[model samples]
Target: MPSAPTVIQHPPRREGLGPPIAAGVVTALVGFTSSFAVVLAGLQSVGATQSQAASGLLALTLTFGAAILWLSWRSKMPVTLAWSTPGAALLASAGMVDGGWPAAVGAFLLVGVLILLTGLLPVLGRLMGRIPTALAQAMLAGVLLPLCLAPFKSLGTAPLLVGPVALCWLLLLKLAPRWAVPGALVVALAVIGIHLGVNGTYLPADALVPRLEWTTPAFSVEAAVGLALPLFIVTMASQNIPGVAVLKSFGFTTPWRSSMVMTGAGTMAGAVFGGHAINLAALSAALAAGEEAGRNPGQRWRAAFVSGLAYLVLAVFSAALVTVVAAAPPGLLEAVAGLALLGTLAAAISSALAEAEERVPACITFLLAASGLSFGGIGAAFWALTCGILVRWLLKPGPLVRKARGSGPRAPRQ
Candidate 1:
């Protein structure tokens, strides 16, 4: 007899924690170090007075941190959002010349709108699909590599300042993987405490007070072509792409469109609040996704929420937060950031050059990215992709060379 219909049973799935929570916390610390500095740098270039820049910084901190917290919490995903550091660099170098604060704000708003459109448009999804995986991986490596280097470079000036933090980070990584970041922070803080105890004073505080100033959006040919386009490209190519990859790397699958939507909406909020731009945070996501958040990926949202809440608190007292962080000797900040990013850097390099076919191109991309070049109001992140493509094309085998030798399938000779 045809067998009675067979019944199939599926096992219930258990939610668990990942490696990202601890990673997220550590990465967030590093991410926060020079991140706001980029924005302030950009603002200064664009002619923002000290007070305007301070307000802008406060807005950016609050906006990005809150976004990460809210999205992670509501989505029950280890999603994280952060300001686009690369984007800030682009502004600092090129965008400042084209338009002032008004232009920058307009560009930010436009980027948000573009991201929103990208989220809503199915065609954009297909386009994202079309980017070769190897190329995308290389792009991420290119963008993150500089951040990984800053910590080490800062060492030349302040080895004593950075040594203990570096040692603490490495030791914690080896002996207690989960506590590495927190442990390093503790050591750094302890050093600060000791130095202060002996000296009876830390560095004097640099107070920044937020003020209200509304910049009306201004549109110009130069601003649109020069400032806006570059901002959009960096935010999308360098920031959002890697952000999504980090999530997928951890087995989280939310629609790319949805992420685009969140970023677009978030950017708008930031622009209104005097912030430059916000995007997905790859490094911080690593922290929120780590083992400390809980085994269930779904529960890691709490860490994100906590981070966001912390960010808001920082925003409220941004002058104080920035002052404290900035007070750390440049070398120490650099060392801590570099040490924290060691793992992420290793991973990006490994993935970018994994394929023999892509290695030369990827290497070229990485080098260009590390060179710290900016041009015509765009950053190295864009140039790296451009150079990588050029390398791939130049290295491609000629069709004539392939056609000259092969005409027909040969019979197997035994």
Candidate 2:
């Protein structure tokens, strides 16, 4: 027999600057626009002063920015960090605690400690790793469903403002998919500008100056059980776990333990300046880590680094950005957020329903999550995951065994 033909392997193509830059800019825009207001509102709900709210946003952006840069550089992977949007939503709903913002800050610190402990403890890390991808994706889809519906709802409420933005997004999706989100953003900004001009309202001058304020944390049992525990649960279930799954879906290897540790530390650092929680990013992670970020997967880390830089730059102007967002028409931000997240929402649904055996359980998870129900202070995300897992165990013990044996659907490689 002739000797086997020699195999040749080509190295990954080096990515140019454009893809990374575009990816970075998109990631920044989506991350900032989608939920910064929720963060501001949550801070205020807990009784933060206007300066405290601005400081919270600034601290969060800076903390996540540094975390993303450091993690991506260290891992040589696109590792995006984010403040926990769902957790902020939870805070927004939870309202003021007994000790006010100080108690809430104390609760935030406690949550960070819990996250850090989870990372340090092998059992907790293993448990998080064991969460099936389908169920996790389902929960994510559920968490995102309400927000995803915003554009269509906006179309009915403010057709002039949202119709053009949606049309631009669709057109760009067909003609230049990479620019679709940015195009939508441009249309939204233009509409906002027109509205401002027509309404004779201008952005506040003081918005440009970044400010920082600190509140001394006062721990309270009410806040700890009510805010801290629930915030921790939602952040992990709705954000960090899905974030890891997103990375895995893109064939990236993530050191989950280290990521958890870093996010926990970042959250703690941010809490000092009134920031609530920081964690891994799911939707924006895809923007920075996916094929759009770079032709070569190996080089995509640069995109995350660029995103981090963008975030840092955004932090410097966070107050100004908040002012502009606040001044925009009621549904404009929702439209922008929905457009940017459409891709992520579709991907999550696809992933959730990919396996025939897991479909029922995944659907259950999605429905419960989308229902947005909370009980005894715990959010729906956790309950959704728990119910799905229980149903999976009860209905398909065989597949569950295989899953436990590491032979099920090869969940995102890492």
Tens-digit lDDT track of model 1 for 1-414: 797998888887754333443445555565665355556656655666666666677767776776676677668877777887666655654535455677777877887887788899978756755654555456555655655666677666677767777777778788977567657766766776676677676655446454445667666655665556656666776677778787788888655666678778877776754566788886567777666666766677666766676666557655654455455554554455445545655766787788998899888877776665667755555677677888888887788866865656889999
Model 2 lDDT on a 0 to 1 scale: 0.82
Q: Which whole-number lDDT from 0 to 100 does residue 199 have in model 2?
A: 99
The most accurate candidate by TM-score is 2
Worst lDDT run of 10 residues, candidate 1, spans 15-24
- So what's the TM-score on candidate 2? 0.73
Error of 1 at 340 (Å): 4.4
lDDT of 2 by residue, 260-315 (tens): 89989988888978999999998778999889997889889999999999999989
lDDT (CA) per prediction: 0.66, 0.82
* CA lDDT, candidate 2, residue 327: 76
Clashes of 1: 19
